[model samples]
Target chain A: MAQSRNADGNGVPPVGGPGAVSLALTVNDITRTVRAEPRLTLAEALRGPLGLTGTKIACDRGACSACTVWLDGVPVCSCMILAIEVGQRRVTTIEGLAEGERLHPVQAAFVAHDAVQCGFCTPGMVMSCAALLAHTKQPSADAVTAAISGHLCRCGTYPHVIAATVAAGAETKGDGP
Target chain B: MNRFALAHARTIADAAARATTTVADAMTAARSNATRPASLIKAGGIDVLDLMKENLLAPDMLVSLRDVAGLDTITEAPDGGLRIGAMVTLGALAAHDMVRRRYPALAAALAGAASPQIRHVATLGGNLLQRPRCWYFRAAAFHCLRKGGGHCFAISGESQYHAIFDNRPCAIVHPSSAASVLVALDAAIELVDADDTIRRLPLASFFVAPGRDTERENDLRPREILTAILLPPPAAGLCTAYLRQGERSAFDWPLAEVAVALVRNEESLCVHAVIVLGAAAPVPYRAQAAEAALLGRRVDDNAARAAARAAMEGATPLPRNGYKLPLFEALVHRAIMAAVAETL
Candidate 1:
């Protein structure tokens, strides 16, 4: 929070912008400093500056969920938030959803059920579905439906995604999200 | 999106002072080119970023309200009502226990809004003030009336998803469905200006008809910041419901929406009623004639049918958007029936 040109006593002044600024961002449990423009979106920063292409950017707008990421454990469109505005909120992308050398339950189920086609919306879809399982132990089909309602799957794998999410929820051994 | 300086404010007064200054600069710039906002206030950045990306309004500075204290909470109001911070996200409002149990209609409206990701980041204040999703207005290539052009392209061009009522030169419908429910609930909004002067107004008055102003959507003054939404105390016999018809069940903007608030006695006679239509007009269309048909009468299938017919009165739909009439009629009837069925 202290890394700002606008750290005046009254309040923060206008920081960053129009020019490239060195900004620190915590991604996948590691804080990486990147130099980028203020107008650059978090999705762009993650994929470009941070070199994490796992978080795809299809629409580059909020219309698509291809850029979905966890901002403090809640699913939000990465394209909707400015990279500079992410501040201290820890961003968890598709890359951080798995354990060491092991895919998350939702990711494993996606593979098992063949829920990937073009795989453009896969990362975002997986991020939202995984967030749902973190809280719901046994999410029903409707719960999965509601969780991924914002996601657009051109592959028409709605049934497969729902099945994979429900199976992942049921397969979880303990309270882990 | 243009590269702009991000200004953070810690207090309401600080935000307002910076906001007023920003607006003054923005208006001055608007006088010449009117291509962008000089300095803009951003809540969730959902709509603001959309505008910036589409080249509608670029800002030299964005006064971020994300750091403002006490603006991201939901607490009980002194009048025994719910005081929702302007920054409260739709996701939090929908998942809130009290909002779901006591104000089911509001929760339902919130649930039907946008997608999960949008509901998580889009704030209440930002939703109320979001720009119309009209294609012409959004496309930078075409300069429409809202964009300081002479004519509204939707009036002569594609208007399949446009408004059916109260749309004059600008045919685009209001984008928010929650604004309808809030008006039905008789909510109020608190606004604080740069002078630290806070004032409240009925939520109904907050929306601005296109006839009144072609560009501005709501009564939000650039110099003022909406701090909170004050919901009235729950009435014992009140029943409320919100329903919408859209292209898709989820993730699509509503084609037509209806929100109803009815206060009926134990015998099921209506004592008071409010029916506000969303995505059907330039603002939340208050169907006063529809409400009149239900006053002092037993709310039944016959009453619902009569009110539905009355609600569609005075509609002047443009070409290719007449389908909204039947959609609004059906939604109003279903919403009325749905509101009454809550107690059952």
Candidate 2:
């Protein structure tokens, strides 16, 4: 939770000048320092600067779930959050979900249930479902819908998404992962 | 898209000190800049960023409140009430065990709002304090009264989404779906000023009618921030519910919504009642007559019908919004009946 930035006198005025800022972010158990444009959102910073483009950017605003990530354990639209303001908070993107190619239960359910169509909204949907399953091991159908309601998919694949979430919960019933 | 410069605040006190003082201050700040400079109170930036990209908003400076510590908590008061911080996101409040158990209506309202991603980012303060979502206001071409134009186009133009009650000069309806439930629960808001001065007032008193001031919707000024929402403990034996009937399940504003919170006394008689109508007025309409109709009476089918009938008594419909009256009446009836049945 501790973060510090260098006051390099590179601060630009209100309109347009310098494009980047010195930011320190701890993402997925790795503390990485990067210079990002002031206009660059956390989503863009992770995808562009850190080379983790798994965090998609669909609406470019908070409305779409393509850029969703867990900021300090709470899922938020990374596009809405400025990269510089992210400081040293822990960020968990979809890239951080698996351990050495072994798919997480949510990911396995998504694969087993054929939830990814077009695959653009998969990262965000999987992350949101994982967050829900983290809190509730066996969530009902309504809970799954509410969890993913903030995400929008033009593919119209809600039924499959719900199935994947329920399957993930059932698979984790023994270990309660 | 052009580059956006930043004015970051290190603390809440620092942020408040840098904010413009009043409407006049905002206008002056806008003129002093080479561009259309305005203050975007960065409460989660859920709605602000979208409005900006849509060109509906182009503020020169963004004053962020996210750095304000102690403004993202959900705690139970010693009096058994709940105090929700302004910066608390809809997802956090909805997932809170206390909110889910004590005020199920509030939890339901939060859950029913935008998608999971949106709920995760949209703050409770921004959800209530955000402006109405009138198409005329959002579209740059319309330039309606809400956009500082002289006439409200919703009256003469496309008004299918306009108000059904308490709209005088402007007919735009309030866009908050959570506010209806909050007001129905007799919630109060804790407003904090730049000087650290604070005031706690009922949520109903926070809204201003269009007849009073079309230029603004609430009593909030430039420097004041909605710090907390205080929900009085649910009355004993109460069962509250929020019914929002919208054009679509997700992302669309409510066409008609009702929030009913009621409790019966030891004698199985109505002791407390609250009914609020959404998408009907400039603000969340407190169904005063409907509440009066149910006072001290058994919340049976007949009483619910009478209350619903009285709810639409003061509605003044426009050309096309006349349909909202019946819709709102039926919604209120259903909500009350559900609440009553749960209490039994």
Candidate number with greatest lDDT: 1
Docking class of 2: acceptable
Worst 10 residues of 2 chain B by lDDT: B22-31
Compose the digit string of candidate 1's lDDT tens values, residues B154-175. 8888999888887788888888
Cα error, residue B96 of model 1, in Å, equals 1.0
Candidate 2: clashing pairs of residues: A149-B115, A149-B116, A150-B115, A150-B116, A150-B117
**Winning candidate number (TM-score):** 1
Report how far residue B275 has shifted in candidate 2, in Å.
1.2
Q: List the candidate 1 regions with Cα displacement exceeding 4 Å.
A: A1-4, A12-14, B20-37
Supply the TM-score for candidate 2: 0.88
The digit string of per-residue lDDT tens for model 1 on A6-104 reads 556765455556677778899878998998777889999998878899998888788879999999999999998888888888999999988888999
- Each prediction's TM-score against the native? 0.95, 0.88
DockQ of 1: 0.72
DockQ by candidate, in order: 0.72, 0.38
